[model samples]
Target: MAPKVLVVLTSQDKFPANGNPTGWYLPEFAHPYEVLKDKTELVIASPNGGEAPLDPGSAKAFENDPISAKFLKENKSLWTNTQKLADILPRVAEFDAIFYVGGHGPMYDLHSDANSLVLIQEFAEAKKPIAAVCHGPTVLIKAKSTSGEPILSGASVTGFSNTEEDQAGLSSVMPFMLEDELTRVTGGRYVKAAQPWGEKVVVSKVAGSGSTLITGQNPASATGVGKEILKALGL
Candidate 1:
């Protein structure tokens, strides 16, 4: 049987402070989905269970990318009818991995979501692969390992960088800068590409359980993150 991957997406559609629309980045989810869809069984899920929103800016920016364009046109139902994260927590064992897709949305919702934290912990305790990209790593900020240490402690990780955030002109709107938070939790091992928005994927082992934790620096690294997950899963 193909390995099953639980693809977690954000349901928050608007930024709280400005009410500017934000959701999962189109390329971040679409690019990775293209890489994993054929090799693994995937279940799309979100905090609230339905209608995971897409970041309109990402959609417009990457509209010309064939894979993302096709995914947007064909996979609407997957995002429109996501399984609730809480509902999937009980069946976490059924999945071989958990992937957190990113956008500004996660910084607001999944970062402090109780169910997301528990689910990540369960995956770590089970030594399952945990992957996240861009702002998705925000979810890991509050997650703890079985040993009670921050899940990212002593682990090399990468996510959307402060430079990229500022370049995107969302530095002020984001709840917290991903690079700073990830570095704090990882004890300064948070890595990134030499250049902003460049592709960078970091694969590390959870400190206690040795579960694979794969992360990407930005949307450009989404496919790399997916490939790393497949490698970790031995697929």
Candidate 2:
């Protein structure tokens, strides 16, 4: 049997004023879900529990793309039965790995969520690979391991860059930019692709730690991020 992987998503359903609702982008979450489900048992969890909204605009390509549509329909159950982040507390330790799916929602919600923070820390403490993409890496801003050290400290990682934020016309909208916060929290150099919306993923092994944290630049990096996670696990 394939290893069991917990895919954690943000449940924030509202967008900031004059902004778009931020949750998991359909392609970013669905593409990885499709690939990972084929080799592992997948479980979905979210911050506020229950349903996660998909950024409608981000679903544009998948709406016209047949393969993405089929994958979406096939995973309807997982989509419908998302476990609340709080509800998954006791069960987090059971997963082989954890993946945080990004959307604008994470920018507003993931940082202050203690349950989400703890779970990420739990995975880090266990030395399991933890993966995130796009805005998903926002969670790492405040995620401290059991030792109280921020997880990304001194670890090279990438996330939805400020350049991408500027390109998306959301530089002033988001509560905080992931690139700036990740760098501030860890004092580590956070890097990104020179261009916005490019596929740039960085996988770094936490200094002297067995766990590998992988992050992708934008929605475009979802599949590459997933592939890196698989490689990290030797799958």
Candidate 3:
């Protein structure tokens, strides 16, 4: 049997009503989807189990790219048929890894959500790799290690930077900033690369073991992040 991987997405659509354009970017999700497609049985799940928003700007800008074009063609089927996170109620030991795809929606929905926390704990306890990119790392805010410490504590990780939020013109509106919170939880020792919008991937050896929780700095880091995950999994 092939290894299975679970992919989680934020179900949030509109940004706090008056906020700027914010939602999942197409390549952020699609790159990983395509990479894992050939080797792993992939399962897509959303918090609410309905239409997962695609940042219109990403789709419009990259529509001509081969991968982006393919994603657009299959967009409806992949998202519409997505399973509800609640329905699957995944146990981390049942699969090989869990990946969280980022969009602005994750800041609104994944953080502090109970179900998200459950999945995080399950995956972490099972010692399975838990990979995230961009604002996707926001989901780790609500997760705790078996010892009750912040799950991200002592783990070198990176995510959407405050610089990126500023570039997106969302620095003022996001409920919580990723840079501040990640540092706070990690005791100011977390590592990051380049600027907010740059492509960077950080693979941290969690608990001082070879097991890793890989993260990508932003959308551009998607494919590299997926590659890092596959490398850590020895795939």
lDDT of 1 by residue, 63-124 (tens): 99999999999989989999999899889889999999998999999999999999999999
Candidate 2, 1-235: lDDT as tens digits: 6787888877777777675555677777877876676787888888766777776666775687655687676866776668888888898777888898887888878767989898888888889898998888888888877777778888888888877788788787778778888878657678888777878999887544569989988878988988887887789
Error of 3 at 13 (Å): 0.1
Candidates sorted by TM-score, best first: 1, 2, 3
RMSD (Cα, Å) of model 2: 1.8
Each model's total of backbone clashes: 0, 2, 0
User: What's the residue-level lDDT of 94 in candidate 2?
Assistant: 78
What is candidate 1's local distance difference test score?
A: 0.93
| Candidate 1 root-mean-square deviation in Å | 0.7
Candidate 2: which pairs clash?
A: 22-105, 49-84
TM-score of candidate 1 on Cα atoms, chains taken together = 0.99
Candidate 2, residue 82: Cα displacement in angstroms equals 0.3
Model 2 accuracy (lDDT, Cα): 0.80
Candidate 2 TM-score, C-alpha based? 0.92
lDDT of 2 at 211: 90
Q: Stretches of candidate 2 above 4 Å error?
A: none
